[model samples]
Target: MVTVAVTAVAAALVMTGCSGGPSSPATDNVAGTPSSGASSTSKSTPTPTPAVVDVTPADGATGVKPTAPVVVKVSSGSLSEVSVKDAQGKAVEGKLANGTWTSKARLAPSTAYTVSVTAAGSDGTPATTTSRFTTLKPAVTATYGILYAGQTVGVGMPASIQFDSAVTTPELRAQVEKLVTVTTSPKTEGHWGWLDNRQLMWRPKDYWQPGTKVTVNAPLTGVQTGDGKWIANDDSASFTVGSSMISTVDIKNHVMTVTRGGQVLRTIPISAGRPGPETETRSGTKVIIRKEGTVIMDSSTIGIKKGEPGYYKIKTQSAMRVTWTGEYLHSAPWSVGSQGSSNVSHGCVNMAPENAAWMYANSKAGDVVKFTGSSRVFQPSEGIGVWQYSYANWVKQSALA
Candidate 1:
């Protein structure tokens, strides 16, 4: 009876422990199986972001200066390509380096431009961006002209560029100088100088070599001359340097000597300016600007009116202009007897009709005419008086100096 009672109590304890209740393996100690209450979740990696592109002169921006550079920047990847197009669908030149792109060519004023950029992400995914902007319209569009264009000139003739508006400051003038380019066939050495605010001229250290071919390019359409002023037109010219034709006029002795390539061509009787301030030919180097066939000489153009002391209007033949102030080497028939003797005319080199015709027929524009022995000096600001200044002094007039 005692053994049966003990076995019954042990059976009751085993049944209680095996019951699917609070003590059934504690719900986490299951064999060969993971528990739902414990953390056994697998982790997954996050996805990477794509590349980003940024453009300068932001999209739809207006009134942008042409000088402002177009820039493109990329992040999280490498730049694939960049394209900038104008309204005409012409591509703007640009360069890319170190993941950045910048415009290499100048933009036009009052024009619309479109920029398209494409880049690749680290995951080899390509992304694109675009921008549109318009350049500012200049208030005053300046104009310019290239001198001695399409002509054969003398060795002493300098390449001249004249602007309608004045370039006020030296800094502005330097900017204008940067737009000019000159080239020679034989590769001559030369430099540019400003005789005044409106005139920019290029001359060699010495006279140009005969038979040299010169070409000039001035892409000044986008150049700024002053505040609110921008050049709207580009200019270019090609000129040839002809044979060496230099003439010397001796006022004291009243004679004119012509030479061609260091050899004496002819010695002609000539009468130069008489003694006086208002009626004396300027003494210095002069470049023949143009040949006028039959010009009416009016003293009023030189500030001498009808009733003035030296006022006279006459028609001269075979006239070659040497100065802006009413001076020329022309045919003066009335003063033929005074030729090579006494200087008795206005500020002009009077020669016989035959002599004047011969000189005009043989000479071209840019021929050198040098006059000596006079009280009045030729100013650099006068007609193509570039030879008056030494090469060193002429260089000092440059904006860069």
Candidate 2:
């Protein structure tokens, strides 16, 4: 039995050596250590960079001011191109640097603007983005109609500005007042007056020198009016002063004298307003606003209705408008004989057709028209009557004063 047991133990040992007994579960490499075996599936694909872009105002925004700041940027990519345009398709000037874009181009008021951009990912994948917005159009806005280029005007042409909305606050008015400046080649002293909240006019203390160059700069973008309105954009004009053409109309003598550079050009017989409230011509320093070959004269337009005394409508030629209250230097053929002898008809400087034509052709807008010898005083609201106020008095009209 001992011999048999020994033989069996020897046999078991040989069998154990021939085949491994129980196999333990295959062990994984320690965490973060390299693995000997490779991945079973095909080599895994690498992750790609994300494509992204952004623009200010998002898209489809409204009530944007022309001066609103703009920005464009991209992430995980580089910006390739960007463009901005207006409703008229004019390009807004911009600059791109340091992976960003910016612009200072002035925009049209109450206009729509668009922006388009392109970008490239790290892997060269192209991506595109776009945005559109509209500029603010205030229900009330300011209008600048006095200053314009190329027209030779008189020294008395005030920078007449009117607003659809009233500006009553002093600070608000000051904000607008500073944005407007008049620079002359010779450099002249001037002052601005608020003719009420809605109108502001600038004029020199003395008449402008003949041949002076005046530049009117009105940068109103983002400027706030006193009453919930802001300036939409900017406007500028340059004008050259022509010869000094001034006319002195004497209501007593019933005569008109035109002068240039202190020399008399023409002295003609003229018929002024008859003695009355509605018929009296304003007697103060005034500027010739504009001229017309023929303007239909209407007394009712001046609040002198039909059946009222001295109410007659007549068509006249060679008309030069001097005041807003229906006063003009026009040709009156029917009153030619009485022109130099008497004050008759309505509130107009009536002269012979020949004289009227000569004056109209020679005179430029801004010419000085001084009406004296009458009790009538020009109101600041009546046409370009800025000369009605003295320099000191005019200074008092400014909010900044």
Candidate 3:
């Protein structure tokens, strides 16, 4: 009976060890089985932070200036794309460089704009942002016009910009001048000078070479000229330099010599202005403003009355205007005998009928006319009198200088 009991107990111990009884459940754990008291837990990866974007003219902004910058930048990421559009869905030209996008063109006033941007984070997580803004409505809008547009002007003519509203302050004038672009073929050197409050002109260091091509672009729309005034329109002009026509008038010799391309064309007999306070022809460089056919000459335009000593109104022929103060080269049939001998007219070059017609026919606007032997001086403010100053002196008139 003792032997049977011992054998039975040994068999039971082996079964408990091999079969993994409740107290020995660790053995089942080695075989990839779960135990009652043990627990299973797993590790998970974390989500990445999103990219951030910043926009100028903040979202829903109103009354922004048209000159204000439209820009987009990204942080904690890289910019992928950017778009800026007007109310009509026309995209404004822009460029992206160094992770920033900037608009290249100026905006229109009183217009709505929308900006959209997309970016990706360091972990390639994408984010998008949008902005909307409206430009301010100017109280007064200014306009500008170009002189000598589409016309071949003389070599002495400067590219002129005339503003309807005066740009008074130097700070404002500099802003306007900076935006005016002058391009020339063969790359001529020039500078812009403010002739007056309303006129800005760009002239070459010397007379332009014949056949030189020039183009002026004034992107002045939205440019602020005053507290409440802004430029409403832009202006552009493309003109060319015509043949070099220069005429020299000798008041002492009483003769006018015309030259083209450095060759003499004509030596005309002329009677210059009589020697007096308001009647003597100005002695300096002058440019032809325009040609007037059969003008009704009146002394009153030059501040002389009918009964004044130098006052006389006559019907003239082939009148070419040279000064705003009423100086001209016109036909004086009455003084034909005195033309080559003496000066007899009142502040005008008195040429014979046929000679005056020849001059008028051959001349164009901005032809150079130099006078000698007169004591009266020509003021630079006169019509197209840019040659009155040396190149060094003229460059000082620039706002940038």
Candidate 4:
């Protein structure tokens, strides 16, 4: 009887545990019922967000030309910020819009640069990226060449430097000026005259001293000028002044005296125009640049009205060089009877053939040719004339001292 009773109670306990019914302790005490440990399920993990990537001007780039337009683009998210910086870490000026950024100016050559970018996703989570790049080495450049250096030529050969391109930067002008150093052999003072932006000329208050040496150097390579321009390469030139030749024309006395190294070579009587209208010759420093055995002298060519008192269509003889508009030191066969006696030619100092040839032989291109008279005011255009104004006045015309 006892075995049957024990078996029955054990069977009942097994049935209670197996059935989907509540346990006796959990059912009896609601607040303190034993909790199922597996009630909390595993939480779903959030998907990993994509990283932002910036493209363009890829990192470690070299031989990159300054002409390359800088541009930056982003992927995987909208761009929040983009910046370009030089090796010095200064932010390069640029613009950004529509997930794209660009720079207006080109980058400098052989320079290292860095770029940083930041982007954000739809969830407002932010991401950042960085890159570095370097430009290619600078190309071989060319510079201006001084054709005639340190040499005293005609005033026509203004100390001129022919540039490869029109200079556009103040820095370039400064650089070019620094390369030019002039010293007068006789210690005469001079200054550089910038005729135009591209053409720079140098001249002394007076003519360059005989035997003076001038040096010109144009070293403009790899120099940065504004607007992506630079000098081409390196060049140098030097020239020396020749013998001392000077001549004085006395329009009042109607004579021209030729000299060499302070020694009077000869004096020839001449004639100048009667003072009236523009025919009167002005007196100042001048230089003879041409000498012709004979030359056509058409009064009409020089604007002298036909039938005018001084107007005559004819060829003049023994014409020595005078660079002014219409003037010469020549033989006046028509006035030979008045040679050394009277002033009879039109604004020119007329002389005999022998005397004119002698002056031509002794004179050089840069030799001083001075004229003196009271008939006309010395103007700047009267031959290669410098006596119209004082040396101080000449210096004032130069853009640089």
TM-score of each: 0.85, 0.69, 0.80, 0.52
Q: lDDT (CA) for every model shown?
A: 0.85, 0.79, 0.84, 0.62
Select the stronger candidate by lDDT from 1 and 2: 1
**Model 2 TM-score relative to the real fold:** 0.69
Q: Which stretches of candidate 3 lie over 4 Å from their true place?
A: 1-52, 76-78, 88-91, 120-129, 305-315
Per-residue C-alpha lDDT of model 2 across residues 1-401, encoded as one tens digit per residue: 00000011112221222224544345444678554433333344344565577777568889877557667777777888989888778787788889988876556568788888877766766667678988778766655444446688987787666776677688888977877887887878889888778778888889999988888777776676744466665778888888998899999999888999999989999999988887888799988988877999987887778998767789999999998788999999999879889998688999899999999899889999999999978898788767888899999998789
TM-score of candidate 3 to 2 decimals? 0.80
Candidate 1: deviation at residue 291, Å? 1.6
Q: In candidate 2, which residue pairs get closer than 3 Å at backbone N, Cα or C atoms, i.e. clash?
A: none
Which residues of candidate 2, in runs, are more than 4 Å off?
1-137, 140-143, 146-148, 162-172, 222-233, 307-309
Error of 1 at 142 (Å): 1.6
TM-score of 1: 0.85
What number of backbone clashes does candidate 2 have, counting pairs of residues 3 or more apart or in separate chains?
Answer: 0
User: What is the C-alpha lDDT profile of model 3 across 1-401, one tens digit per residue?
Assistant: 00000011112222221333446644555756654453445555444545677888888889888788888877767888899998789787789999888988787777899898778876775666778889898887777888888888888889999888788799999999899999998689888998777889998999999999999999887798878778756778899989999999999899999999999999999999989987889999888887888898888887789888767789999999898888899999999999999988888999999999999999998889999999899987777777888888888878888
Query: How many angstroms is residue 238 displaced in model 3 relative to the true structure, after the best TM-score fit?
Result: 2.0
Q: By descending lDDT, how would the candidates be arranged? A: 1, 3, 2, 4
lDDT of 2 at 12: 20
For model 3 the local lDDT of residue 392 reads 88
